[model samples]
Target: MSHLHRAIAFTATLLAAGLLQAGQVRVAVAANMAIPMQRIAVEFERATGHELIPALGSTGRFYSQLRGGAPFEVLLAADDEIPARLEREGLAVPGSRFTYAVGRLVLWSLDPHGVDPQGNVLKQLPRGRLAIADPRLSPYGAAAIKTLGGLGVLAAWQPAFLQGESVSQAFQFVASGNASYGFLALSQVMRDGRIPRGSGWIVPSQYHPPLNQDVVLLNGGRSSAAALAFLDYLKSEPARATLRGFGYEVVKH
Candidate 1:
């Protein structure tokens, strides 16, 4: 077994023996996951009596904060690399990292006919801004660039680019009609297992690298019973179901 799994097992033993008390766990979650996390947190808190305190932002920003000694106990990142880097740097528990979800990218607009199913709207886009998250900070934003590049429209759309610090903000740019369209995480626009309104084209996964969203137990949380229990709860069926409801792909445990 991985060291983290063993540790979690031991922690479970302690809990079963009534030696551990429920407490709060501070978590850093990617902005794209904020809504789903909120739902899952409600259920988790009700079931386990453990409070989850979440800080939502871009993965890159969280990495910088963690490097600067942020006191977050767990990380649910938008991409796999940051968690891997944390493990390598000893900021997180080695072997405690795992991909919790695979993110999907979408081109979305508030108008019903704003985007075509095949995303051919880019070929003759209207004269307005095209929103995207900052590629340097958001995996979804990076995927947007890759998608445009693959379609050979990067140059054509360069002048109209409008960048947001995170995918959630990019969605806002489009949702508020400040931009004609925005590249966003599927989760941002999904509801009831589908896109509830406006128009969106789900970008094919091949357009960019797989957005393997991973979660890790940070070094600071290794000794916290609540943190350990939270990690275990994340792999439960209820949590995985919540992830899927938001259009994120979850790996079978």
Candidate 2:
């Protein structure tokens, strides 16, 4: 074979190798999105041939990591504001941010009678433990505090509260009976709009600001094609339907 023919063959091999190596996208996601994001990642990998590496935590912690040079290509955060800030700071790719899901807070309990959907349960439980994510750090925790205040129970329930570092941990606290009851994401308690295990109350939307979960491509200046693709997939009709089925509200805008 001529020298040119051998060179062409070698280049073809290198291109194939590069394609194989580009089949993964590292993602940093909020802990509250763990379960749903796992399901979405599975489908995304199947559809796009890109493996998702998710690092889940509170939005505040993840933001710090991203700023500290964590090698992440995507962020699925618990709120839209963080993504907006990242975009404004040029840490995230502009025009790549979009709302993925609207989170809902629920009062949940492992105890059969610890929660009542139609009753003011907090007023009845004078000293019962109420688990919540730390409002100083977690967005869900902030919402929980706001909701409690809105309902006129913040001061009365302050002494009975147990705080978790992340929303997932807060839910686990209640689920394991470490606390008699707790605030959690509605999606954590419901499947197909029905609560499966212990009792829960879906707090009225009017009680707190919307929990708008957002996704954005980090400006890692790497091959974020797959990351951007997955962001688009999250807004696809089928994906939105699946999220809604899991009790997450689909963002209209």
Candidate 3:
């Protein structure tokens, strides 16, 4: 081959390699989404040759970070309202928001067959501690509070409660037997619909407002091709199936 032609071919190959290497996305996610998001991140990296750096925390805390100029490309929040607010404030890309999952609350206990899903399980507890995330700072905690109120068990069960900073922490509290029963996400309790090492009651969706999980591409992430690709992957059929497998409800809208 001619020297010029060889040089041109080598340059083309380098460009292709660079394109293929464009696979790193940074994401800020709500702590409740940790497990499912980790699973999805692996699948995404396999399918698209991308790496995901996920920062998990309370939705409120993440919002504070984003507002304070944290270097995140995307935000996976517990509620759509926060993403909408970010968009309105020019922190997120306009029209780049979508609901990813409808979260479910569960009343979980460490002992097998410990919880009674029927009604007023709190009244039957044998002096064991109950754990709940703090309602003022965590969305899942707020939902739990609302569910308790709706079930007419709030006032009766107040003294038995132990508070966690976040839903995942609350789950940990129950899992470690620090609390006998705790409010947790259904995804946290169910391993293919059956509970893992503990008994849990899948709270009916009607009892509380829908736990809509939303994702948005931040304005800073717009220039990140990998970030955009990861956002698209979250809505893909395989991703949706994985989320459903983990007991999260996939929203069509």
TM-score per candidate, chains pooled: 0.96, 0.88, 0.89
> Which regions of candidate 3 are displaced past 4 Å?
1-20
Write the residue-wise lDDT of candidate 1 on 1-253 in tens digits. Answer: 8777877888777776778787899999998998888898999888677899999899999999999999999999999999999999999998888888999999998989989888899988557899999999999999999999999999999899999999888888998889999999999889759999999999999999999999999989998888988888888898888889899999975
User: Which segments of candidate 1 are over 4 A away from where they belong?
Assistant: 13-19
Which ten residues in a row are the worst by lDDT in model 1? 11-20
Name the better of 2 and 3 by TM-score.
3
Go through the candidates in order and give each one's C-alpha lDDT. 0.90, 0.79, 0.81
Candidate with the greatest TM-score versus the true structure: 1
Off by over 4 Å in 2: 1-22
Q: Each candidate's root-mean-square deviation in Å?
A: 1.4, 7.5, 7.3
Candidate 2: minimum summed lDDT over ten consecutive residues — where? 3-12
lDDT score, candidate 1: 0.90
**Candidate 3 residue lDDT tens string, 118-191:** 64576553468888888876788998899888877788788888998888889888888799889888887776
lDDT of 2 by residue, 1-253 (tens): 5432343345345444665334567888888888887788888777666688888888888888888988888888888989999999889877767888998888888866768886389656455788999887678899999988997889988898899999989988887778888888887777866888888888888888999989888887234556655665686787887788778889764
Ranking by TM-score: 1, 3, 2
